[model samples]
Target: MRQDEVEIIEREICYQGFYRLERLRLRHRLFAGGMGPPIVREVIEKGDVAAVLLYDPLRDEVVMIEQFRIGARDDARGPWLLEIVAGLIEAGETPAQVARREALEEAGCTVLDLLPISSFYTSPAKTSQRTHLFLGRVDSANAGGIHGLADEGEDIRVVRLPAAEALLLAQQGKTDSAWPLLALFWFAGQREAVRARWSLAGEAPPASA
Candidate 1:
């Protein structure tokens, strides 16, 4: 296993002749439990991912997308959700490149400058997903419309709202998704700087600090 890289070297797994789905002999290790030899576990490493939750300072709004999510199905949070614009990093794509591409694909806006917010895992124990969240300043006015790649069965509706209103919704738990909620509430605390950042878009007047 390389510390700098995610690659891991698995020794082998000798199952007890148990046949199951995929019938691949069910790989395991020589030892199990607290007192045993150091064995290799199923190591599914993750790659770095970049996502942007855009805020259009000029329109005093944030750019979000509404879509149906299976994970939140049959829940009070609502299966359909307003989430920060995001996508997985494609091959040979940088975080910045993913951010700019998703902005146009999901919201039809061009990112003027991408402001990083945080780098954290969407979940660690469950999956090896790492997310680098960004706050992109874009033109929000006339930005809302239907967007998304149809080939992937993605039916996305763009939503732009006043930053204050989004913050209020986040506080009230009206909006869904963790990244957007975090970004909104974070901006809530840094309203002055966020407002200034939005002002750079110049698509609308600067929001009051």
Candidate 2:
């Protein structure tokens, strides 16, 4: 429960590349009392991630992306998965900054405003990756086509679907990514309130040339 309750016996870097893998041997206080036996675990240091679900309340549509994912290569649905805009947090950038930048880079949609949604661990058992999620307001009128940094080997295709259709996709287990599913579910429950709030905040700015 507390940091002091755990004692680190040893930590070693098992692998290092684009991401680092560390093996840790530690002991912690048991719930029943007294210290437990030492445990060894390997964790992938993936850093933190920022993800945003781009929404156009005025048009009742959502902007999503389709990209090939190595992790899902063997799945029946294929490796190309539908996902929201997301990127890892670079050195000095904030989660919100990453969200806005990723929205434009991945979907070509400029985020006019943002509403924080959630912060969560993607998979605690394997990776130390946390994601900061948001609902970003955008004008989806001209949001489309392929985007992403070429050097990064990112070939992403922008997809736009009506809000209802997108939600149905999630309900049917089509939008398989955890981030988008979570964001879409949250948007479904808060859709009306968000629309009202954003409407009162004033019209969204026009898209840049």
Candidate 3:
């Protein structure tokens, strides 16, 4: 269909200091058929952001960072939440690039065979941030290290733990971040199949290749 053939006009500013604002300015209907002007529900969604979920299949572990999350610092729980490697997509960086950069800077590991999981709004009701989730297998034996952007005023502590231990901690409600648990489930649910796939292809093969 052409532009004139569609309806529900939306206006948006796709860039700003730290975000892009989108708005559904007008709601209208299309000339579909004899169906009394086809209607459309107006929708305004954010463009994109990126998140990295690391899974170390070799060690059966996932590396997570503990940091003083200012957003949740004063939540009913506490500060210093556990989360997967995550960040917003910069002006010109791809999701894989963000994943690699975050993996090295936050967890101090070189990720291999990056896999994309999902792209979704972190919270649509409040913020217009679409986060792209990625899965990366890394060498967890030497993952924990002091790595973060001090110039950006970021202080992070990386830690590597067994998948079971991480899930247990989340189950006990120790960490306030939600992505860790989601990642845990994603990784755990696919653990056997991923491992089997990895083994069949050999360590030298690529998951996405």
Top candidate (lDDT):
2
Which sections of candidate 1 miss by over 4 Å?
1-47, 197-209
| Top candidate (TM-score) | 2
Residue by residue across 46-129, what tens digits does model 3's lDDT show? 456667777777566778897887778678767778888887677889988988988888878888878777777777764666
Error of 1 at 14 (Å): 15
Candidate 3: stretches off by over 4 Å: 1-47, 199-209
TM-score, model 2 to reference: 0.94
lDDT of 2 by residue, 1-209 (tens): 89899999999999999899999999999999999999999999979999999988877788999999999999997999999999999999999999999998899999999999999999999897999999999989998999999999999999999888999999999999999999999998998778777663567622211
lDDT of 1 by residue, 103-172 (tens): 9998898999887888888766434577888888887777877899999888999887877777888988
CA displacement after TM-score superposition, residue 132 of candidate 1 (Å): 0.8
Candidate 2 lDDT? 0.92
Candidate 1 local distance difference test against the native: 0.73
Q: What residue runs in model 2 are displaced by over 4 Å at the alpha carbon?
A: 200-209
Residue pairs that clash (backbone atoms under 3 angstroms), model 2: none
* lDDT, candidates in the order shown: 0.73, 0.92, 0.70
